[model samples]
Target: MDLLPLAVSSVIFLLVSVFLYSWKLNSSGTKLPPGPRGLPILGYLPFLDRNLHLQFTILARKYGPIYRLWLGSKLCIVVSSPSLIKQVVRDQDTVFANRDPTIAALLGTGGVDIITSPYGPYWSNLRKLFASEMLSHANLDASYVLRRNEVRRAIRNVQEKIGTGVDIGELIFVTELNVVMSLLWGGTFEGEKRDRIGAEFREKVSKFIELLEKPNLSDFFPVLARFDFQGIAKEMKDLLPSFDEILDYVINDRLKIMDSEQVEGELPSAKRGKDFVQILLDLKEQNVAEESMTLTQIKVLLVYSTTIT
Candidate 1:
């Protein structure tokens, strides 16, 4: 009588059978760490709390430091506790040291930023170039003047709001954000623009963090990983353009400086502070001479550098 439900059940049974067959074929005899029991289709997803960290921590306590949890069809290995963390981070560092795939990183970064990028020859080279060029001690020292000025401005803003019963959380976020923005973009926002950019960046960063920390069913269940049940892919597509616009502004401003025949030391007293952008541009030139760096690679490096710091 209920042929629709029967049909749906048949399809689900077929999928599960296929998945089990594949698992049996490829899975090694090596045993995974203990974990909570998972149900069909949903796995352990229904058991998980909305706050992933707390949920995992509870499981870690019960199941030991290393335990697996299923989010939908995917099985995720959660590593917790200080001792296990140290063992992975220090002892077996290399074996555990690999970046997640591009799609996974993109879900968290809104683009291919450096921090979430997988460990590879290209990533290694780009990281080294950034370290030696942009984040070097001399470069950081050069940018100190920018930091000082921005800090002073932040203090002044706080002073003005001393008795206005301002939101401490908002104030602190804006102050820290301005310091970072000045280091990266060479100026702080003011008036309405300040509030807007600060709010926008905060929201974007929060979303990115949320996406990264949450367990995706697709990430664990290779068979169903293609289906983005959480709408993570849609969110990434929407967020990337705004991120690109910010990056474009940084890159274009640096290029304008390079096009001007002005030497760094000869910069006016007011514009003397050299920021990360200048350092990255110089690295880009070096990369061109040593290896044929493409435009996309250069842009990727810049995007990565900005995201990390």
Candidate 2:
């Protein structure tokens, strides 16, 4: 019995050792695209600049249209040539279309929103909802008045600040926010509350964008993700709750309206007008697309439809 046990242990140890050795050999033999070398372990991470696009352009000129760099342990392939871009984005669209959602995006969206959701059945449904339901000519026509009013408000806002060198980007962002929110829910933010909320939203969104672009060690080194040394993931998770709370309020408020309208025996089409929330809610009630539509999915759609615009 002792000999049998010893022999079994020895065989297991030998198999484990052989597997590790083979894995090391395979990893060493794997080919990757060529680019500048960097320090051990850290890779080219320490030398990256804030203006990464400019650096990428210079590197592309030196390293050719396509090159790879190791950002920590993550291998990033950069394609600069128009032909290569077209190949990736067009010809092999499906093959290369899926995005690698960053830690921040995963937290912010709960890994469900259409933009960052992995390509699959759920993503397909979201796309169909956008193309078939939301972007229909009828819906666009219904939303025209809201867009026109918001555009007019933007014009007035700009006019009031005409002599003060108003920031054009800020003006456009506010205008888009107003238009998108109005179309999504058929409501407008106005007066002091609007100003306060708009400022807060812009600040939070700006910070979110910065964090999204900032390289997180967790991204390059999966082993370090749990530690979140940069706090990028935590910050994004915190910011998301505020936005979610706002979206929740809007969603619940719409639900209340839907309940009241149902009790009053008002047809949904008549009671809710042509806003996006109403349309989605109506679809929910029909129970026809149950697999494709869920309450969580609807909420995710509403959040992104307003903000992403």
Candidate 3:
């Protein structure tokens, strides 16, 4: 007889039983928002339209302002009312502040970056660092010259290419790239090296965004994460090292310069132009302890700041 199919069926039956039993136990006396009953195991995922927002609106109209959806095993609560959003975001902000990050996002940030990081001391410290050090008025003023120079360069380049026509998107991207790199490292590449760096950065950022947006089975089924069904995790892991190497090169180059200056007895005050990395390294040297920035953290922040902008 076919014992294999029978064994699989038995396992599935037991899993469903356990799932329902636990669900019943937890939900016995609780009232959940109304939602469409979905098929076993898959939930409402397979039935969702490509226009998810439209679908959500339709569901909200039928189910009232707030509704619940079971996407695979994940339970999603949707609130469409402005008052409810205000209550969640402003009135009781701390209660709902933490995020349940997807597998891809978790992998991308390594569970350490500001965006996907859970609400805690670490996130608070990072927020303070960003506000007090990175995006402070003084720092913005200091970066004005760099920003002005890059903007002027972009304008001049576009002016030169006016008659032939230029890709506005590409122009803006290049200009932004130059400005961000200048702020981060205070150095610019030239000729082939510049072209190569630009291509590399663009490629990696594209891949990162693509991976982030792609629906992975691992995200839907946490137990199946190790299998990496869509290979998004693998692609992300591979993409990360290249980004690390580039950041490492910039950091090491600056460190070498700083070391040479130190050897010549140059004080920290004597350093010419200060970049974001240098400022972060100084903070690291101050032994911020639990709030201290690591090399990985620095690189991650750099990526976050540039790409997010």
* Top candidate, metric TM-score: 3
The 10-residue segment of model 3 with minimum total lDDT is 267-276
Model 1 has an lDDT value of 0.64
- My TM-score estimates for the predictions, one after another, are 0.76, 0.77, 0.85
> Which regions of candidate 2 deviate over 4 angstroms?
1-30, 158-170, 188-207, 262-273, 287-292
Clashes of each: 3, 0, 0
For model 1, how does the per-residue alpha-carbon lDDT over 1-309 read when each residue is reduced to its tens digit?
879999999999989866774473237226777777666556677777778798887887899989876566555778997888898889987677775553546654443345655666655666666777668788778788878877788778878987677787887766776666666646323467645754666566666556666666566565765777877666767776776676676577567766663655455223557665566666667653245555455555644553566
TM-score of 2: 0.77
Candidates 1 and 2 compared: the better one by TM-score is 2
CA lDDT, every model vs. true structure: 0.64, 0.74, 0.77
Against the true structure, candidate 3 has what lDDT? Answer: 0.77
Best by lDDT: 3
lDDT per residue for candidate 3 within 71-128, as digits (tens), equals 7778788999999999999999879979888887888889888788888898888777
Query: On a 0 to 1 TM-score scale, where does candidate 3 land against the true structure?
Result: 0.85
Instruction: Kindly report which residue stretches of model 1 are placed more than 4 angstroms away from their true locations once superposed.
Output: 1-30, 102-104, 107-112, 130-132, 187-230, 263-270, 288-308
